[model samples]
Target: MSADKTILIAGTYDTKDDELSYLADCIRGQGGGVLTMDVSVLGDPKAPTDVSKHDVAQVGGSSIEAAIDSGDENVAMQIMAKGAAAMAAQLHSEGKIDGAIVLGGTMGTDLALDLCSALPLGVPKFVVSTVSFSAMLPPERLAADIQMILWAGGLYGLNSVCKSSLSQAAGAVLGAARAVEPPKRDRPLIGMTSFGKTILHYMVKLKPALEQRGYEVAVFHATGMGGRAFESLAEQGAFACVMDFATQEVGNHMMGSGISAGADRMTNAGLKGIPQMVAPACYDLVDLIGWQPLPDRLQGREAHAHNRLLTSVLLSTEERREVARLMADKLSTATGPTTFLLPNQGGNEWDRPGAPLHDAEGLAAFCSEMRAACPANVTLEDLDCHINDDAFSEQVLAIFDQWVAEGIVPEGVS
Candidate 1:
């Protein structure tokens, strides 16, 4: 490939010479630049390349000989991942790379995925690998960001089958680079969370209001993965502020509910130093698949059968206190502006008066405990309104606006 639209082709150059060369030719035919980097442990590279063993060792901090001598796959994998990331970062800084492509077997796939993850989201990055058809952990982690995996069947060298796959992979990266536009940020990006029950409320008022105010609101369903996706974007600097309403997932995390957002859901915004407006929007209960399928320990608890497929188990005073403490601790780390608004009347639709699981005492205890544990920088406000109420939404928006005006949000953040 000509050294002209920069593309970094990384792989075990000793093993996949034909496939790498074919891909390089395809890239050059499309008028793209190519820089081949040899990631092989052995000294002999079958193909001609710009970056060699010395360059890889200098960037990766470990020689291939050391990695091979150790005979530990995990350690070698880690070293390769670090090396690829460093090289990718250096290329990105030099503004020489328009995209990147990697061809490898299972180990190669893992290394490529790690390097892709290191690049900022939206960069065109692809991997042609033998393990792509399987549900691999690396691809799952790099979803929609920078990694695209093309499954090449069989473990052997790049035969006819592998060559075709590599060609298609090359085309994909070039296509993506030509078609994708750098993200435009004319409006502030607001992160919001919702569940099936609250989707109507959000669509009707909250989303529209934010959009009308020159903000791009991204609504994530509070499923197990949905919460994590939102947090990932926040960490990648995709959001200007957050409106975390469906915090019910935290209850799942605390009570072993099936819909837990792992432990990293609520802390991303805080760690990223983004201004956030939080609420116990649906933390009154933990969600389960169905009332009949409830665990034996949860059998006697009051439950709300929201649908045939979903049920919510009410939290006791003690459980509510625990949840509140968890929320407080998570929010306490906020380095930027933050406000935890409590809907005193109820937390969710089922927490209202006359609801079977409604318990004023439990809610009161949660509010008090959370307030006590919250950091001095985080302001706690108790609004005498339901979470879905227009007034409550407006109050939260006003607080966000105040923070923005005070320069709490970093300057130049849309």
Candidate 2:
């Protein structure tokens, strides 16, 4: 509702000129500023946009002439998407736009994803699409905090139903821009990862300890989306250090499961030269949707159904060993100091003795493979305890303290 907040309304202005203009009017009616970016490649809007198609193509290192010459809709749109994304990022960097609302069907949605991803985590991004929440959009393709609304009955022309979706999306993006509070860098921040307390309780102890030392702690759940967000921030060099304990996503990806954080999950912090203390919590389990048929390889394997929406399957010893090798290979490329914490007893609650998903041989195979494959650059701490044990948390703090003392990790503010 604030007049000072500006929202970037982006779409194919040539085809959906009426729709995009209505969205802009809705924002203006609420006393919010608007910036329009036209991603239409073939035709022009009746009037000019805040950013034109020629400008977008030029920014993407091509020209409108070149795009038209290509004669392929997909290729031309891709060119526009790249330019539009770069322009959005530029606008935000230059303090011109506070948030963005992109409108489209399938093609527009594809471009919208890239545009929103170009912005940082906290800036509001709303996508009003016909394919809202459709399976065609993969988890890895979404911006972590992207908001979407179904453009019900609003595909071709403006009607009451479509207008409702647009009006709400316009207000939502503006309101979010006005109300959002992005994390401040007042203190050094630590990015840690874990599951819930039932399986990994180390965060309950580690978070407060890290904060007491004058650092902020952010513990990310290692679910598919959560890991995507964690990796996105890490790619931006957002953390002073990282405690990456729950790496189930890596195993999920290696096992070809649908419940995966993208292939580059465990590599971001290292690529950015952020000091990381890593562990394999939940490394023995590959989570699958509870309602779906189990994968053939996991047909008779031990499993624990977390709920109607989620299930976890224990990996065989050979699979565990293979995953260990995968983890080591990913960690081997870190440019900064790295430590690997290997717990001998168990990785998670379900892997403890007599637990439903417990597998001693698999755990042993994982540990043995990790001990052998861990690169020379990574310090391997083979601890005689479960990942959930008090000693594991203590070892983490001790190593962090040592890093601070050795100047590998900077001291936190008082």
TM-score of each: 0.77, 0.97
> For model 1, which pairs clash?
188-414
Q: For model 2, what is the alpha-carbon lDDT of residue 405?
A: 97
Model 2 has how many clashing residue pairs? 0
lDDT per residue (tens digit) for residues 13-61 in model 2: 9999999999999999989999999999888998999999998999899
Off by over 4 Å in 1: 1-5, 15-32, 42-44, 65-71, 104-106, 128-144, 150-154, 159-167, 186-188, 195-200, 211-214, 221-225, 248-262, 284-321, 346-369, 410-414
* lDDT, residue 356, candidate 2: 85
True lDDT of residue 297, candidate 1? 78
Query: Candidate 2 lDDT (Cα, whole model)?
Result: 0.92
Alpha-carbon local distance difference test for all models: 0.75, 0.92
Model 1 scores what on Cα lDDT? 0.75
